[model samples]
Target: MSNKFFSVSVTNISVAILTTILISACAGNRIVNNDAPVEQLQDLNDYDSDGVIKAREKCDNTVLGASIDNYGCGNQITKMEPFKIKINFANDSFAIPDNAYDKIRVLADFLKENQEIKVVIEGHTSKVGKVNHNQTLSEQRAKAVVLVLIHDFKIPAERLDYIGYGFQRLEDERQTEEAHAANRRIMAELTHTEHLDEMEWTIYSVDQEL
Candidate 1:
């Protein structure tokens, strides 16, 4: 074979091997994005001279693909403010149901795209159990969601925090399961007060070097 053909074959083999490794490493935590490539996510910053998707724009999600000016953040996009998305759990369990996946996916994607946002996922529980037990469960549920975000969604760990509010933050004291269920949820807080790019962390120098 010619050197060019031989080199192409070797390159293809190497790419395949590397892809396989990546897939295996992330298999257990991968989320299914029907539109995303099967192997990995395309960088959200793809753009053209005119700032359009290479082809006609089919999305309103981000601007990068088409006529987007700010990494697909739409014109109406606001900084990640203190927003709460509730994830309900079955009685006495912290297992996230299959139905809850999409919400988590959107959250993970949002956090990934906006680095200035730090989140505190507070888990809450109804008053059915002892206060301590409820607190522990609530914290565990929040951590569980964090783990899923890290392992499956590839969200960085440093950007997340988990806390159990127990029944302390309950919405109401009604005795019905429906009311209790309402109390069992995860609420997110945006810790940074400024826009991501404008937020700064400063380090002060001591008078003497340690």
Candidate 2:
């Protein structure tokens, strides 16, 4: 054969060999038989005979499935619980009664023990006055409890929040003296914040491309 023809033949052979090798490599990486069982398929992108691709799931896999959220990741959900106290105030007064001090102290102790737990002092009032006046009174009642917890019991002010619902969230909505007394109250709601950092990580991981 001529030298030019021989060189061209060799070049064509090399190109064919390279193309075959590339095809083999790609085939080796994929699941060849679509009708194969799930156990026979390998890797995350395996497809079934119906052309449905399998999903790859990543989970926290903690004990009792505690750390898993709806997306199967370690997302810590902050839970809140009521403090075991029945804080009642006299009619038309925002003062924290001396009788309720002991219960407030119990709440303060809980805060002191669990520093990571913050609290919201919710104040409510009876439906006996104008909307604005009752709202102000409820706010004062919540603030009074907050001040007591911060100043008297030495709980950190940063860990405390207060809100006034006034007559909007009455315990008993009857037009009776007892219902009004029951409505004028303060409640402590404990919030968990220790897992917030882990929760942020979970959110970021979800937004990332696989």
Candidate 3:
């Protein structure tokens, strides 16, 4: 009767397992190409090149290379020069003042240069004449100025308007010669919205700059 025992070594088992692992690892090694979806950089492209990228650009077009703000939009501004034209007249006349050509020419040039503003030719009168007569005279006087703007200065007819104040808006209540002369006059006035160029690119300062 003999008792025989075979001792199993863990080192041999480890060696065999290591060999299997090496073979499996070698078999798993193969060239694999992954066709992944690459993101295109077109989103960052700016078509107008107005310093704002396409993703966040509000205004795409920059007019006349004008100045722009952060949102790729342009700043628009308009200014009316302290413009006024006064033409005095005789006691009962709508004729242009003798020394008013220079002012008229300047007015014409201004109207031509600035096509955005419309003007109203205002006529006033002294307190001496009848109310109805004064009103009619003032109306004629205003119309005369409007005609000058249209014919002489080439200002558009649509851009010029006429209104007469007569004795209603007398410059002076006194009947003095100087005061009467001041009252009997016509003047040009321009009124408009605060922002002249809303969507366009423009910058101006009335009486501030040329």
Candidate 2 lDDT tens digits, 101-159: 89999899888888889999988999998999999999999999999988899998999
CA lDDT, every model vs. true structure: 0.75, 0.78, 0.77
Q: Candidate 2: give the clashing pairs.
A: none
Highest TM-score: which candidate?
2
Cα lDDT tens digits for candidate 3, 1-210:
223322346567788999999999999999678788878765777778666778878877655354667777765554444455767688898888768878788878877877788888888899986999999999999898788778877888988888998889876788799899889877777855442213333455443345
Task: Please write out the lDDT profile of model 1 over residues 47-95, one tens digit for every residue.
Answer: 4333444344433334222233443223333444656767789888999
User: Which candidate comes out best when scored by lDDT?
Assistant: 2
lDDT for position 114 in model 1: 76
Q: RMSD, each candidate, Å? A: 28.5, 13.9, 8.4
Q: Report the Cα lDDT for candidate 1.
A: 0.75
Query: Which residue pairs of candidate 3 clash?
Result: none
Ranking by lDDT: 2, 3, 1
The TM-score obtained by model 2 is: 0.59
Better of 1 and 2 by lDDT: 2
Show the lowest summed lDDT stretch of 10 residues, model 1.
Answer: 195-204
